[model samples]
Target: MGQRVAYYRRRRGYSQAVLSGLVGRSEEWLSQIERGARDIDRLSTILEVAKALRIVPQRLLPGPFHTTPRQTQQSGTIGTAPDVVPDIETAMLRYDGIAGLVGITDPGPVNLGHLERQVELSFVCSQTEQWSRMAPLVPGMIADSYHASRQAVTDAEKRRAKTLEALVYRVTSGMLDRLGEPRLPWVAAERSMAAAEMTEDPLLIAGGAWRLAVVLRHSGRLTESTDVPTAAADALRRDDRNATPEHLSVYGSLMLKGAVGAASVNDHSAVRDYLSEVERTAERLGSDRNDFWFAFGPTNVSIHRVWLALELGDPSQAIDLADAVPLDQLPPELAERRVSHLITVAWAYYLRRRYREALDALTEARMAAPEQLIFTGRVHTMLSGMLRRERRSIKHDLRELSEFVGVAG
Candidate 1:
């Protein structure tokens, strides 16, 4: 305990009295922490002190020392390692803290450190929160995969290792783009391309490129993003079967991206056309046997369906689809997914001038996933539209939402 406190304190160059003062504790209490006399299980207090020290809260927690951590479960299978789950669980908590910070849930460096710690802790675990916890680290994962390619001990190892990296990149990028941060997705794209090149895997490359394109489109570079999915679909079309798990995921993700992008621009025709492609892609992906990673199961399919419905100006359908998510098999994973889905539902309501309902849905979204301001834009758009439509105003609530996201209404 003493060692942990002293370690972070020195790393941040904070004196004992300074940290004590920051946390509103006595230097004597802080001394007890550094001398191993304190239990340190009182993480809230320790975290408070660590925040004052401007160090990641994780730096103060016991690491994998006492626990015999487990290796990752084999691919395409459920991983039931208890020790590994702790780090994963801790990462989720961290991600929640950071997301709250990003949404202006708290406006202090302490909260900022919480977000960084979440990202850092995620790397220490094989699986973080399925979406929010893992998405932010896509760029670094690509970089690591690149390094691993060079370290491949055998030819078979090379393909397997690099392919795994590409898959990670796609999963993270897919989720990130939907979560409203295209810039980070682009970084994942570059990494995906490099990994694909090293392994000579076109599907992997297309997946990454597709994600980058989606990012570009969402970032207001619609034409450029449109090209990505077009090229990826073209690349897949040339292959033996455009239905491989890799190809299916890439195709499905791109289709979803395009659908959402077109909807954003109020292009109903394009949205309908893309929605057709989405159904076809889902059908094709159904034949793939992989369950753990790229399952693209009913729950996942429903998630996207809700998003598409929201985009097509159908709030009721979106809510119905989102509510169909089966949470029994994967609660944590569903927690994040459910949060994202609710945001779309809220937006659909917001679009229809249903302020109270939209607010209700948005509140649920925040409760489900505190890592991102999932409904920020849609809420603002709805509020503005309502103001004009009814000649009534809800700027007070808009300001509240904006403050949470560290933005202005």
Candidate 2:
């Protein structure tokens, strides 16, 4: 561990003093860390060091030390390896049809109806926050969809197959992102865009762009995230035929993504413009609706406003907006969305030093989606920090949360 730290530090052109200062440690302490004389054992310190070095925590750790555990067959237990992530990566990268062509495997007959149903189930599982059920389904979905696209005979069949494949990849990317597997999600997003382009449907293409833009935003490519979706939304607007609710939902969702990306970079002006566009679309739609699983509607728009306020450092505004947004009113299919909003609300409370409210919100989120909550890196980090700073009055409750989220108190 020390040697790896030393290597990355030097590679990043950061001297011992600079690196030590960055992590709030002394030069000698950093040297000891780099020379095997001392150990950096705490998860928070490891995270700090990794952040200063601009690398993942896994890179600094010796073995498979993912901060978030992937779901295993067992309902509540955490696993060490996060095996499902690697399996999904292998399945997506292998493109199993090649093995079938080489006589190593059999690519079965294409079944568009079955594939479509499976895709729908995956989306439902994701939205409902069933990580255990949804994750195990992804590898088979990816491999089977790829094989189906290959075996498709007619042009129409091929397009249908490709659309299913793209949707599968898009959902897979989102799941992987939530699982804290950084690189594989980008691969899935790229595959989604590539598959969508082959179908020549602008709506499908825009959906792909939306997925890619979201992944980019999470990956910290804020400029490209905002620009890509903005361009796609503009193209959709120029064509009068693309103004259907389905297309408009996707367009509005893209604008939401742009708003998030803009807020992340502190571009308040861009955020307002993008949000105005989203509001216009939401007003046209009349009420909350989930078209194309984009979940673009007035309630969804309000949720984004809370997130945007939080991102822009206005915790008071975020909390106020969150209070008005009735997450319980959201349909069962939007469970993930609801829990995610709860997390943002918790963050707002945390920022305002209202630890009890933050803990209550997180507790509510855990009750709704324990597996998903445990796998969120931001939640883990926040809980860890809370454990460090929480008052003695709330120490027991905060510690319980720390344990639940797999963070050391």
Candidate 3:
């Protein structure tokens, strides 16, 4: 990675100082990075360097991301998806966008209400980390929701159906992202945004933007991800004078997404600004709430602080922040968030070389949401990293975790 950075810097005719200044780093830091004496710990920092060098982030990425790792390799591609992913992908691609124009045939009269209920149920299942129950229903939901959206008999029903379709697409995008199947999640996010637009609902549209931002960040479109959600957040602010709880919920959630994106690119100012705004928004909302399944509130804001701290390469700060979070107060529907926080804690522990604590946190996360573990890329990557540097005392437990997350030990 250092060698690639040095090569690109020279190719661009950038002196070390110029490149370092561009990324807000000192000349010595840049020199050390180029000499392989210092590591760029955060992907965001790498992205900043890549942008300064005017190359795709992948060009600066190490080989592990490009190919499967052999034994003892610390980094690499997130492995394959489960069998269910292909079926979900097929359902997503099979829709021709002419479904509304063509109408439904086999399913008889489209039950928009029933379809809405089922979509809501699927979201609940997903939020609660019930992957096995949610996974099988998704393909059908996508197909049927499209049909219902196109076949709506009235403006009210049309809005309702379109909203359902948008939510379904959001769910699908999230599932694909969690499963580490990248490309289709973008498609699903795009479809979600389109479906949301048809409804002309600000909240739903904002929700779509949030989903797209998440997918964009995961795909390494870090800057665009932040811009997307920030735009949505601005739109919401402009359109509402007296924001309701739902409005604030979605707004705060967008701010949170923007904060994460900003952190990913090492934009410290942007991250601080976004977090400050979100903290204020969370305070206005008074407590934790799951409006539109965002799970945005005070607790969620603190959770983001921990995550953003970690993203900024401050493992100690992240661990300190994690200690103060009120995890026991998390709603049962927010099992997904709880699991994610646990993983973040595990990451913090791992970074601090507290191997036993990391393993214990990961174990707690898996125990909290076992089915969700297989779909998460972090679990696989971290397990592989731990396996590469395993201590004899925890070797057996670590291997067990690697097996659980399907990483070869």
Q: Which sections of candidate 1 miss by over 4 Å?
A: 1-146, 157-161, 164-185, 239-249, 284-306, 312-332, 374-409
Candidate 2 residue lDDT tens string, 1-409: 7889999999999999999999999999998777655555344467678889999766874432254554444355443325577888778767743565555464668667887888999899778677666777788888788788878889998999999989999999888877767588788898999999999999889989998997776665667988999899898889746478887788899889889888876789989998998999989877788877888888899999999998887889999998788776688778888889999888888767788898899988877777667777667646865775768888888887787677886
Give per-residue lDDT, candidate 3, residue 266: 78
Residue lDDT tens for model 3, 1-409? 6789999999999999999999999999999778755556677777788888888876775322112212222212223224567788777766655544555355766777677788888788778666556667888888888677667889998888888989999988887776656478899999999999999999999999999999888667888999999999999998567899999999999999999988887788988999889988988899999989999999988888999999988899999999899998898779899989998888888878888998999888876676556666566656766786789989999998787566787
Q: Candidate 1 on 313-351: residue-level lDDT in tens?
A: 566787677667664444453454556666667776665
lDDT, residue 388, candidate 2: 59
Q: What is the lDDT of every predicted structure here?
A: 0.54, 0.80, 0.81
* Prediction RMSDs, each to the true structure: 18.8, 5.6, 5.8
Candidate 3 or 1, higher TM-score: 3
Worst 10-residue lDDT window for candidate 2 reads 72-81
Error of 1 at 130 (Å): 7.7
In model 1, state the lDDT of residue 206. Answer: 65
**Better structure of 1 and 2 per lDDT:** 2
